[model samples]
Target: MARQRFGLEGPSHTGHDVGHWDGLKAGELRIQRCGACAEWIWVAQPLCPSCHAFDPGWEAVEPDGVVYAWTRTWRAFHPSAEVPYTTVLVELPQAGNKRVLGLYTGADDPVIGSRVRGEFESAPDENSWPLIRWSAV
Candidate 1:
């Protein structure tokens, strides 16, 4: 195996949540759920904080979700990502308030309480990871 190249220059999943992108590629929303309490977890943790259970598993989720929160980022953290990107906190119905953070596809069409869906974009290079971009509906 070789060291993976991350960041804007590499694949979209290169920065963080590489596993999440991998799941998306397989047509799943890939959320971490606690096997003990059956509660959903975000930001991907080794164990469920709610039940403190070491048993955690990934489950498929609906790509469609409500926009819990959003913001327009003027700063370009990644060179590949255009500036003024929309970042959103999506609340999945299946997760019961569990939120996933991702970049909005159409930054100009942002709505606070609108419905949105996820679309995973392929990386420019294999070294880069796929990105889950969102669009408001």
Candidate 2:
């Protein structure tokens, strides 16, 4: 099936999390890592949760993971979003078991521990933000 574009808005792409959107535009999955403790921080924080270090740097990680958990939503939260969409929490082993949330685009039901890969979709318009979609591997 073709890649689906979910009409959900993301967090502000400013400050610490700018690299994440930039990475998606460049076809990479960039995440922050604490320079001191090397701990992966998701949702992009200014300080490392583990070591509390300032100015954590960003690194490109492989967009491959397993479905740690998931849920199917029947409600359309946004105008661009459709009913019966699935969101999956993917566990990235390459990034120290850090889980990244993304939209699931597959026909079968979401099964826990299923291998999935990331697919970055550019925004339909300049005003909208890009997103990562996951597919079963």
Please count the clashing residue pairs in each candidate, in the order shown: 5, 0
Which ranges in model 2 have alpha carbons more than 4 Å from their true place?
Answer: 1-14
What value does the lDDT take at residue 92 in candidate 1? 88
Alpha carbon lDDT of residue 45, candidate 2?
A: 93
Q: Tens digits of per-residue lDDT for model 1 on 1-137? A: 11222364321343334446667667677887877798887777767888888747777887889898988766756655555666788888878778877777763757777899988666666565666778877
RMSD of each: 6.1, 2.2
Task: Give TM-scores for every candidate, taking all chains together and pairing residue i with residue i.
Answer: 0.76, 0.86
Poorest 10 consecutive residues of model 2 by lDDT?
A: 1-10
Q: Write the per-residue lDDT of candidate 2 for residues 71-122, one digit (tens) a residue.
A: 9887867776667788899999998888988998976788998899987777
Candidates in order have lDDT scores of 0.70, 0.83
